[model samples]
Target: MEIAIILISALICMSVVAIKLSDTKLSFPFAMKKQLFTAAERQFLMLIERAVGNEFRVLCRVRLIDLLSLKTDTNKKLANSALLKAGNKHIDFVLCDKNDLTPVMAIDLVYGAGKDGHNVQRDFFVNGALDTASIPHVRIKAKNGYTLAEIRECIETKLIPLRRRQGKIPFVAANDRPEVIKRSTKPTRPLSTSRKAVA
Candidate 1:
């Protein structure tokens, strides 16, 4: 009877794995999302792009692992545990330095005031990680009406100055936010109307 029971258990486990294998082979009922960002997110992204100007490049939907990693001294087991705990969590947007693509600031778009404790804890972890790395974290409320000036003030006036003092931002950037300089291309020499130059 004990042997029969053991055989039955083995069969049940095999059946379970077989079912899982078949499920994995089947195509999931997935549909492609129509848009990556909602209208509000798109608006905020546009504001960030315009506000930071050509100084910084903006990246969206970046994973935390992509931005940060555990210290080298961390043991493999501890590292795996920490990574497993935080894996798959992502930042909404990351602003990077244009020169070497270093992550300058991490931005989270606050959709609404409806966050629960879990979200608060997750944000705490993310913010703490950014702080540990000396990278600034900014949370901007999602609004349809974010002006370029307001975003610029938050980034340039507030965050950039602090990072600049800390030497996080490279001194290569100008004191003033660099603007596109338009040089009107005029003929170096006046075009002679007479065709005699062709001879």
Candidate 2:
């Protein structure tokens, strides 16, 4: 009888331990919701959608962490610094190439009384980072309505120069002397000179 009691006690102990272990496991208390944007943001997104129309893909509220990265050697210090600067922030809209999803430009929407001093400083920092990385960005003030033409013009103004710079290639003349070609592996003219030529 004592042996049977001991076995029963061991079984009860094991059951208790199992219950405690199950309680310790992680539990998710949250549920997924559909609406992700505020009312004002939705209105702005509609404007962006209308502006972009069928030409380019517009992504809303893109995380800065997803966009910016340190492409050089994985120096933890530098990587951490870049992440710290960009981790919490997000761009209002990102225009991308429809085919390959290459980011064409980043747009920030400034609303309500224009950016204050702190916002100005933040903008300067973000602008500096984008410029250093050779990415084009534009800041647009939130207004009642936006015209497609205006948006197109703004994008084209920045994109045209970038496209020109990216498309430029060295030109070699068929009639150029063999000696000149032999002396120079590439064209002597700079890319900026080619830009002028293309223009």
lDDT of 1: 0.80
The deviation in Å at residue 36 for candidate 2 is: 1.6
83-107, model 1: which lDDT tens digit per residue?
A: 8856867888899989999998888
Looking at model 1, the pairs that clash are none
Instruction: Please list the Cα RMSD from the true structure of every candidate, rounded to 1 decimal place.
Output: 19.2, 14.1
Give the TM-scores of the predictions, in the order they appear: 0.64, 0.64
Put down candidate 2 lDDT per residue, 93-161, tens digits, no spaces. 898878888777888887666543214334666787788777798887667766778877777777876
TM value for model 1:
0.64
RMSD over all Cα atoms, model 1 = 19.2
